[model samples]
Target: MEKREHWKSKFGFILAATGGAIGLGNIWRFPYITGKNGGAAFVLIYIGCCIIVGIPLILAELSLGRRSQRDAVGTFKVIKPGTGWFWIGGMGVATGYLILSYYSVVAGWTIGYFFESLLGTFRKMGSPQAVASYFDTYSASPLKAIGFHGFFIVLCMIIVIRGIQGGIERACKLLMPTLLGILLICIIRSVTLEGSLAGLTFFIKPDFSKLSTQAIFEALGQSFFTLSLGMGAVITYGSYLTKKDNLASSAVMITFLDTFIAILAGFAIFPAIFAFGLPPDQGPGLVFRSLTNVFNAMPGGAVFAPLFFFLLIIAAVTSGISLLEVITAYFVDERGWSRRKTVLTMGTVSFLLGIPAALSFGRLQGVHILGKTPFSFVEGLTANYMLPLGGLMISVFVAYIWGGRKAIDEVKVGNPVFITGRIWVFLLRYICPFIVAQILLFGVLSEFTSPRVISFSEILRYYLGIIDIVIAAGVIIGGAIYIISIKRAKRREG
Candidate 1:
């Protein structure tokens, strides 16, 4: 067997994990969702979700990985043999593969736009409509789209092939700080623009009336997705952690840093959007179309345009590395593949898988799966179904099958007397699983039903309210009673 590689330092592990968490979603998706979901109200709700859901899951995955000293699939096998629970890890590996496949295509677009911004291409386009047209044309070109997609995949391959200390850790150390530095610069420039305060006001002020059931669920989903949980990326990174590294503090730091960057990204982009009088809810095009117009019109636009896109590329690459790593680790741990063979083979295959998504914008534009483009279909499948289900299963397995007592013992390896083990396990055992199951159920219903007939939120509000209340009460009461039993057991043991 090949010797396993470990992270060189505690800080290296934190940076790499945080880099994985801070991805394109943070750049493009989170801000727009915040804009659409009542700004500060949604932001506060999201923070609460992170505390209640995100950290416990992180701790769960990390402790499992480190304790098993294996990849996601292997972690399950090592921990619990002769059972089907390893399929959970298999699902996670598959989820990472699917997410990274098309994700690289979008990452490639950031690379393409970075160069275009550098060459003053957006400067030539006078209106957001003009920039939107240019984006349409550019995305429609099969050659450019696939070429950059391949390019980004190759970049990920290069970094991951070098192994952990020399590659992922080293790259993330440089990338995360640079990402933050550039983000700070963008925030400064964005807020200094004339009339930028309007954007800031819109972003920071809470309007409770604007908050809806849909917005609450969106916040829950965003908090879950933004942390990169349920996909085995965290598990793979955690497998590299040393026994001395504190899982609790590390999870907290990673979550805090990731959320901070996401909020700062809003600060960076929202002020510019409002200053230019662009609609806040510009959807996915907020980055490529709306921001390009902002860069074209704002003072010192030329210099910051490239910086902004470069920041995006770094963000994409960081997360891309994690997704690719999840797949690569599987092969290395399970199949006895060398790092080079695993990275090269899997990265190439991922790039090939992404080609259809890349071409979906251009040559494959007419093709639709289940009434959506290839890119949209795959993105929806992973985000809506696979990730949430994987997360829900992980929480259930750790809390029930693997047993929360075992999980807490594993987590206590670095911090022997940590008091929050009960709390963490309570959330992992009860709260996280229930919420993620709701997300999964809601996503399925939303996908299959015509919102024109009856929306999923409406179903939740009008039809399922009593059942939801019963489930919530049961979980809370069950968790509290379970905690008391644990306390009694500890007392007897003492």
Candidate 2:
């Protein structure tokens, strides 16, 4: 059989990869998380983690994928051979599927907001409380949310079914730059607001007291998810790259662009919140509710409000397309399914699964899978636990078992400049996996152990307690031992 063709242009690959990275999470989650977690201190930690942990893992996944030239499942099978590491690919595809189910629902909100903004619905909505209630009403309506979600899912499926070059690449090329441009415009406008400097200071100022076990762990998790690392999204996308493509440079570019958008979003949003005297820690409603109010209060509230939401919708749609492609590609490659079949089947399944999240606003509010939690339990489990575990597995598989060092060598073969081998090896072999595993274990334990309504002082005390440090250390050591033992067994076999 003839060899499969790769992405013809670097722009296509970058756009597609970036489309996966820049999503609703960046726009909605980043600002609020930054505010609650010591503003600038958290942002700094997040950036550090992104470079040290996110970039290396991205290179590892891309190297693995490009070398194998296969979907997520096939990539693992090629690298690890007889080992069951290929199941990581399956996990990734599943994770993408699970995420898109609810993710599309949230994406639907952006879509709805885009139209509402355009029509000047927000112009008359004067108060933050009114904007908050608007979100509450819409979020609780299952039928309306489902309608918009279906629209978003279909749009994603249409683009994904067209293959990498024709559909995914073209959309990203047009959208990514536009998304960045909108963000910069928003940032410029926001920074000029009265008291905007306070928001900026809040985001950039460091508070060492805020450094706790849980905060560090949360930062680690955010770094992983925000960059779309460890869930096989990057790896699966990487499988399409040509041999001459520079994995290191590509990873760095993707990380930088992703981080820039996230930070820019913070700059745009927080200033507006402060300007309007809205609460900084508005939880998930910060973007949908608080920012909507800010737009209403602005001079040209109607015009800018719609423009902001339009950019958000575009960013979200592109990201959704990438997630769908991961699963769609797996089905096409592994099960020999047609692209249309794969797209439709996955979309239908995701659409149905999204109903719970949609209904969580009202009727299903009492439905708790883990315990007494409401809307975010399912989201939290997948993001905090499954994503990190998948990442740890990839780190170990590439760094130790699957010849990631060898793959890195292959990746650097044609480049004029090379990444520092020692640093790359150190991160791949020790630092990345250790950090990821620590976050995963500690995050789970803390969630289970910590009270939901604890006082601020008590929460602070819990973070600095001896127990937290021991837990973090134990998790890291456990990962190192697992990887070392696997390497030893492989050596013995050789």
Superposed on all Cα atoms, the candidates' RMSDs to the truth, in angstroms, are: 3.4, 6.4
The sequence of per-residue lDDT tens digits that candidate 1 reaches over residues 1-494 is 56899999998999999999999989888998998887888887788678778888999999889999999999999999998889999999999999998989888889999999989988886666889778888988999999999999999999999999999999999999999999999999999999999989887888878877677678778988889999999999999998988999999999999999999999999999999888888788888888988888889999999999999999999999999999999999999999899998999899889988999988999999999999999989999999999999999989998898999888888989767788787787777877888788778777766665465457674444345435546755765787688778889999
lDDT of 1 at 53: 83
Q: What is the lDDT of candidate 1?
A: 0.89
Question: Looking at model 1, which ten-residue stretch has the lowest summed lDDT?
Answer: 461-470
Query: All candidates' lDDT scores?
Result: 0.89, 0.79
**Predicted candidate 2 versus true structure: per-residue lDDT over 1-494, tens digit per residue:** 22344686987888879879989878887887877786777787678778778888898888888988888998888877888878888888888777888788888888888887887776666656777789889877877787898899989988887777878888888888898888888888898998788787777778777665556656777788888876778978898898889888899999998898898899888888888777677788887877887887787777778778888888888889888888887887788888779888988888888877777777887888776433476687778677888888888887788765585686685454453544566777877776787667655655654365344434654554345345446544764676677668778989
Instruction: Spell out the clash pairs found in candidate 1.
Output: none
